[model samples]
Target: MTDATTTTAEAETAARPWLDASLPVAERVELLLAEMTVEEKAGLLFQTMITMGEDGELAEADPVFGLPSNREFVLEKGMTHFNLLGVAPTAGAIARWHNKLQELAASTRLGIPVTISTDPRHSFTENPGAAMLAGPFSQWPDALGLAATRDAALVERFGDIARQEYTAVGIRVALHPQVDLATEPRWSRVLQTFGEDAELSGELGAAYIRGFQNGDAFGAESVSTMVKHFPGGGPQKDGEDPHFAYGREQVYPGGQFELHLKPFAAAFDAGVRQVMPYYGMPVDTEYEEVGFGFNKSVLTGLLRERFEFDGIVCTDWGLVNDAAIFGQPFPARAWGVEHLTPLERVEKILDAGADQFGGEACPELVLELVAQGRVDEQRLDVSVRRLLREKFALGLFENPFVDAEAADAIVGSAEFRAAGDAAQRASIAVLSNRDAVLPFTPGVKLYVEGIAPEVAAAYGEVVDSPADADLAVLRLQAPFEQRATMFENFFHAGSLEFSGDVVAHVAEVAAAVPTVVDVFLDRPAILGPVVEAASAVAGNWGASAAALLDVLSGAAPAGGRLPFDIPSSMAAVEASRPDVPFDTADPLFRFGHGLTL
Candidate 1:
């Protein structure tokens, strides 16, 4: 009888050495590989995204990001890996959902537990396509703000907190700690990076990797980190993001190609288990001017040979398939090889030394390619070995389930929230405290904008306008030029200057009272006009008004410095090249600029 038709008694006595955890992980992996069918081996190559319904069940709603229901993707498709999108309401809800998902995996013939990964979920960013909301997770500042504090210890501390929460909810892979340096300040995605300093980015990135991996290596307690945008993604042409066709080229006009490679080396040294290459094609480089996902020279030669990295390399999402997301059509980011067919794209990606494909659920194409005598099954095994090694390293063969009951108590505990709040306060940078107008006396009437009246009233009286208050407080987000698509708008990009109307409004507040200005510098905003208009100015990446008030009122001190230089004007930023760091002439605020009250 075939394996599928075997009885329970026959299956139990099958002599599966892979089921033995006491044996070496490599030997177990080898034994398991020998018994797998071609279809089973192909399942491990796909890592598509999955979403949950409001009731914490498998979502059967209309397609999101052009994806089908989880049942089809997980059970019928034989897929074992998923990047979790959207968050559950409670910690226990996520835990329960994860348990149910794992139950589905357990019923499969091989019983390979599904591995769930997620983008950064502990930050203030709520871009549905890019980052998940920090609901029930301790919300901290974005990566740039962490870099502003310039404390590797603090970054590690945040990572530790993130690890606790992730493990509680059964998240096993962190698809983040984006090590791409913010060399191009105008790039839309800079807000998520660690800033423009290569050395600082490298230092903090290694510390972050250590925290997720649960100290020097991957184990049952560890969450594997996928340090992303390999070879760096910060040098986009004219600061345009590579997710769109218009932003497809990554130019090196400043000729600093080696500078971008620094942080990846640091991540590799830190024993990062996975690497993700970006979508943009490198222009004027020695290698082929193809997208980094298809650049064999970059992946095989530079990463594998020169850097000596022996880890799983996955491509960024949707590089080999054309699909629609949120009703807008998106073409595959086959930048240099746009002329190739979908099958050819897959062939090229596999040949380029990548182990897995992101945002793709097609393995039949590969099965067909192998059947055609074009691609070898042994070549496919190379990636399967790396993938299986991670699963074994994570102890999925033993127990892949989490304590659904303990998830609530462990995730988003009161102590974790308090620490996250303190981090928000500490990341506030006092850029200018002219005449010590801050630290306003308690019980004074205050008029606030963009802050809750009750929150502001806790410190002082809340009034209607600047004319009726002791000091006018204003909170403003960094500015961005509008884009065509709704999804593009989520990524803040373009001009750093405030609009004429915004400048006039802040000036009116400054004229009426001693206005205290707080700018949320997701990316550095040109602050020349705002500084001249306000009596006092402070900068924060992302913080609640209470946290900012605690720092402004001297209950806590603002210790953060400029992680990156703030350009003096749009003219300066436009004049700078895309590949260079801190190249803006005469910055308004230089890197490492911060003051104390």
Candidate 2:
């Protein structure tokens, strides 16, 4: 036979023996492990987010696409796992595409199935911070809104819905339930978290995990939950995020670190199968300078040692290289011990004991490390073993295919959509309403902005703009820092400061009409202007525009209290110590402060 024919025959033979379900999970794992070489094992540990490129190749491969050329490289290097980026238009096409990829990976020795993961897809807004507008995915209300409903059953229901949607299109992992406490209002990533309270965040996060796992003790379609940013990500100094070089420290003064850990403990107790460390470092604290990805104290000492968590621990992305996205040069998360090469960073991360390198585009680097004796093959084996075991635990070997038709039915189902709407309604918190400038009686000429017309119609006549209405409703976002060209494109710096234009506009609207202003407080910003101008002002812990509207129209009561204190000004935030836990002596809105109707 020719070389091509011989290779094809070998591939076919290798796949034939594993179709039997009678084989034990351990036996299957060992068989697969034995078949994989060091190169293949290393590839399994490095997962990349896949999207289509301009040249009809994976976006991470095309030079023009600005992503690392890891797709072609993974195939060449014998990689086995990938996290599907964004959603496809049709569930059928996504399943077909995923099946084809699995076929290619199975063509090699072992026939190991490729496990695809995704961020939360069944929400109203696709988490813009994580993935860009690539294709269609089921959108749902932000987690904060979910928390507002205080319905654990609804949270579980949402999880089941997400699980069905994920399994239908071949995704087996859900990287979510970011159980981090929103203890710091200035933190930019708070919108993605459950909310500020420890007990609530933990309880809801656990319910979310149970919902996703769906009692399928071991199966492929049973979506595994990767509860993330362990030991919590909230409590950053001045509300700055750790994605950038400057804002990498995680401080704790209010003993909030322990509070943050509550949710994770709940998640672990609930049997969450996976964990992802935060990108921020515990600088000027008891822990070392590097991020949790490379912090043994946090990962090995706390999570593994104390909690006894046996789940897979994946790191946040881009920790091993200096790459630029959107015309900015961002360094790999070299937080504490500054002067290290990408290769050196990888070594430190391995030593710190992370199972996988997230957002990684290079398996070749892992191979090179193994070849140079910098990283041990046994260490690679350990992580690979855990990874493969999870695939087995997920029963991927038994059932790799999903019913695409069922997926379409599950996604955006009436039940799930209603849950989203309910969450949106529940999460809205009315912070101030001195004159009862709410529940605008019907037939009142209402001028509204920032709220959808359909949503505003429920209250009264919806106007085209703030100027035309009897009452103006303005939507606002908490201020975040702008990054320089030399920093990560999305990473924020400095304190939470609102735009002058936004403040001026709110004042303009409030002066003309009895206005109600809703601020999407992803990060807590100074609300002096908002509190002073608008007759009534509201804030949401998460992104729930619909929920804010519900509070305005008397459909839902504002029950959420501030998880973190809203700082008075950016200067006060900047002067605060990075090592201290949220001990801002004087804040605008103290923790546990909330107004009721």
lDDT (tens digit, per residue) of candidate 2 on 42-105:
8788876776433223345544335444346446756666776655666666776666666666
lDDT of 2 at 493: 37
CA deviation > 4 Å runs, candidate 1: 1-15
By lDDT, who's the top model here?
1
**Alpha-carbon shift of residue 335 in model 1 (angstroms):** 0.9
- How high is the CA lDDT of each candidate model? 0.87, 0.72
lDDT of 1 by residue, 1-597 (tens): 765656653455366668677789898889888887788888888897888656556666345566777777777777888998887778888888888888888788887888989999988864556678898888898888888889999888888889989999899999988988787777888877889999999999999988888887579888999998988999988788889888889988999999999998899888899999999999988989999999999999999999988788889999888988778888999999999988889899999999988989998888887888878999889999899999999987677889989998988899999988988888889898777897777778899998999899889989997899998889998898898888888878887789999999999999999989999887789999999999888898778899999988888987988889999988998888888999999998998999977
